[model samples]
Target chain A: MSNLEQIAKLSGFSKATVSRVLNQSRHVSQPTRDKILAIMEELDYVPNGNAISLSKGQTMQIGMVTEGINEVMLPFLNSFVETASQYGYQTIIYTSSGDPKKELQAFEDMRRKRVDALVISTCVNDLALLGSYCKYGPIVSWQRMENPQIASVAMNQYDGYTLGLEHVISRGRTRIANAYGRPSSINTLGRIEAYEDAARRHGLAELPQWSRTGIHSIRQGEELVREMLAVEDPLQRPDAVLCSNDLVAAGIVSEARRRRLRVPEDLAVVGFDNTELAHTLGITSIYNPIADQAKNAFHLLLAKLGGACEPQQKLQYCLVQRATT
Target chain B: MSNLEQIAKLSGFSKATVSRVLNQSRHVSQPTRDKILAIMEELDYVPNGNAISLSKGQTMQIGMVTEGINEVMLPFLNSFVETASQYGYQTIIYTSSGDPKKELQAFEDMRRKRVDALVISTCVNDLALLGSYCKYGPIVSWQRMENPQIASVAMNQYDGYTLGLEHVISRGRTRIANAYGRPSSINTLGRIEAYEDAARRHGLAELPQWSRTGIHSIRQGEELVREMLAVEDPLQRPDAVLCSNDLVAAGIVSEARRRRLRVPEDLAVVGFDNTELAHTLGITSIYNPIADQAKNAFHLLLAKLGGACEPQQKLQYCLVQRATT
Candidate 1:
């Protein structure tokens, strides 16, 4: 039998009166409500959350979609989950595994589930398609989209790249080489644009051979040093290298030490994303405030839910100087 | 007006007929059903998922609770989510942040939400309380609990410790020290029992000063070497150290190299959790198959949902030897 029916049979009360108590309707007498609640506790009964949410016209749940997670996104996800939980919202996570079709399916699932809001950590679909999803609920993207209708909270990637480049240049190191991730990624494209702009402003010729893509790991950093730095003539090699992240910079440092090359004297290295690995290795890096961005993203979605149209927000990054430079 | 009301009005069908069509009742004529469905498509009507689920007697959702994530739990969570998603189950996450009260509250939330199953990554609550929750849904714990009523999937810590110790013994190291995480933790307690038993069997003296607790990070490994290994009498110190994890092992190796001490010949280091950091730093570690454990946990929960009483599963660890040993 259903829980309400059992309660009604035991309390000698009608099902409608029992439901009135469950819904906290003032029409029910105080004694009747107390008796129904006591019987509920005795039976260890839990009311249907779905029914309650349906009556309230809100689910009090958020749907979060990501292409996939990496070291950079891990803490952000954890922080976002914690913050949302504190506000009484449960986060349903859907990892698309870098598939655009899967991301679209996740949205469809959310729409059918009727979540209160949507948070897109990664999206590869067209902006117009994403904007159309706004009808289902308020949508927020972690990456900046050109569509004004979608709320976005993202870090300024161009400024981060410029920070790393300027720090190396400040140390009087010209002829700088660059190591980056996938060329097609939005972040990498922004960095490439900033690198070229900085090189032109500094009157430094951009050498195609000096720039390497798909450098994400420490081993990749070491490989970059081997392929570009170990030249017959020392002056032919770049004096400084700008890495995609701390792992790549760590690789460069380890490789340089193995070859008995002095850092800053023989080669200056700058890394991005000041992770603990960067701090431990003392590599100069650009600090990306991922935790802060995650917290703000939750708040931005909350604003959208509150019927406020928030403008796109761009957070900043700063350079943390350390032993490498 | 509600989407259902609009669809009924547009199709010129009675509300009862519209709901019957929505529920796929054969009593509704084919032409009437088609007309209703067409109007639904034009109105972009998404049926109330909660109401549909209420009638089906299942949520098609799972609830996962964790006591805050760490490097070890991150991949495990991702793998579990991906596996669950592939099976058409949406995962709702709640992070308790190591608070027992919060864990209890999360259980209450899951019970109200009526998730099909519950996955507990970490819990410090009483087992009897968790056992009582079985009425709400099946519960699967990542950590091993003494309660036979709750399903669990955990790595064999004692065997893992023995594997690391035996490997070091084979390398001709007699006096070995140990670095561990919180002494009160179940994993550490198991390791302590294994270490004493192995020492007694091998006729090696168990020195109190050789054991260090709360050693988790790379910096702690460096500090351990500085405190114990910098002794003037080389014979008085341990020839090798067993680390709590790869981060500690990496620290030991880095500090030893900085102090001009050769690894293995001077201080052999064995680590746990065979992470990529261990591979990059070349530390011999006991490989804990977290991804496999996560996948198995989901399958075990599925078995529970199928009414199968599964026994507790203890996964094994293997030693991966590298340059550090």
Candidate 2:
């Protein structure tokens, strides 16, 4: 007889019960699990991980696919890994580098590996393509996509942008230009809507030329500010600038300081993603709450894995005021 | 007949050749592999991942255990993941939170999961304990431990510290203080040795109390500088300060600026790790070649997996001067 059968026979338990104990199922009673485990130990039955996984129909692994591995994503990924480990699951991470083809390849690879669930921060906007994979396992996205099949967790970007714009206005700045991230992202779209609404409400002109896109890094911020300063028309120049993130804001501050321009007196800067860069540089920023979002995403995945449905979650954001403004 | 036997009969090849083709072994010729693959496709046979792994004694997975998941380690981890994926391997990451017990637990968990190899950035200094694990699989450490059994990749910390110190001295700053990370770490020990040696070579008194430890953050740097500035004796005050990392240096600069003290005139500051933080703050820092070390570590693991040994490698460090110095 096989070792599993031997353990079942010696422990006076059915084969299914012995299998449950081997898989560490909660249905098995403590004493029964102890008896079965002791018998298996005595018989020197070293359980094969692959064999056990095949039998149980579960790999105890979660696959995480992101557009890129960066400082912005590191804290979220770290929190998710920690939470997943606490639930006795390991995570396998893949980066798609913002390519749709590579993202689909990652999904296919995760399917073949038979991970229990998938958490994706996708660069692609097509939900139909993501929905077709639901047959394999549950998926949790980092963006708030309007799909009935996929669960999601995201920060309220519109409110975050509103907070930054209003803070600048409250600080007595009227002529404000904006620098934001990729134009195609839902995050950027939401922030743009907020910015337009705030400009209209505050009786400020919505200058399409002043608001720029594709500003994600420190160097980009510096370049954008230099370009703004180059316009000899002082009226066209922005008295204040709202940046896509803290990195860009730091760039603007650094470059502005190099020109001997005093912050708040010459230009007020507002940044997003209140990261450590914002704190150290004392740039007023919008806190993204990425760790909380990551934790919520894991809990949503758990609910789905347990054959339950959970409502999509949208977390809140706040403004952190500092020296730059 | 079993599927393997049927494939062997139909293809007129031995079972070993069919098994070798199934495992994607390089020994199989192209024509033979294509023919076998065509037949297998015609039969609609999908290979099971678990069964394939069990039969081949390989998992095609690598385990990465880090002390903590922070911005400092993110770049290294990202590079390693990209390189590993190029070689058809996925990584499983675990963070030990700087606890030796948790580190050991991660190792045991990886062993039970049967990962093909392990790469660790450990907090513990016990090389003997690490050497004992070689019987399971090859281990690559991020620190340069003097063990012939394990492969290692590390930056020359002494050289990195020397570059920063010498740069400050070249800029005419003779009275310099130091604020660094954990004293127990080899990196810190190496930096301290360099600092003492440089001070002695220049015929300067090495004030034991001036070189402070247990500093790894911006707040600590701020606190250390505040304490230093409070001393009434201007003769005992340092003309310059070398920080352990960019974050601490940024803190010193920020705090000094808050007190209206001019940087590089009243107090010069140097930082290690020429990260984006350093660049944004314009703080002069030492450039650590983490990506090179990660790539080299993977190549070492590849050699070991191919039944060969490799020598440990220590990458170089250089200084990048900015306005702060």
Candidate 1 lDDT over residue span A301-321, tens digit each: 877677444453456799999
Q: lDDT of candidate 1 vs native?
A: 0.81
lDDT of 2 by residue, B122-179 (tens): 5563778777777667889777666888777877588989998888888888888999
Please give the DockQ score of every candidate, comma-separated: 0.57, 0.50
lDDT tens string, model 1, B201-234? 8888987898989898879988988987568898
Q: In candidate 2, what are the lDDT values of residues A144-252, reduced to their tens digit?
A: 6667788778766899999999998988888888897887777888989999999999998887887888888888888877887798886778888998888889999
lDDT score, candidate 2 = 0.80
- Which 10 successive residues of model 1 chain B have the least lDDT summed? B306-315
Off by over 4 Å in 1: A12-17, A25-32, A182-186, A217-223, A229-234, A254-265, A307-316, B12-17, B24-33, B182-185, B218-223, B229-234, B255-262, B307-316
Q: Best candidate, DockQ-wise?
A: 1
Q: In candidate 2, which residue ranges exceed 4 Å CA deviation?
A: A1-46, A122-126, A307-314, B1-46, B124-127, B307-314
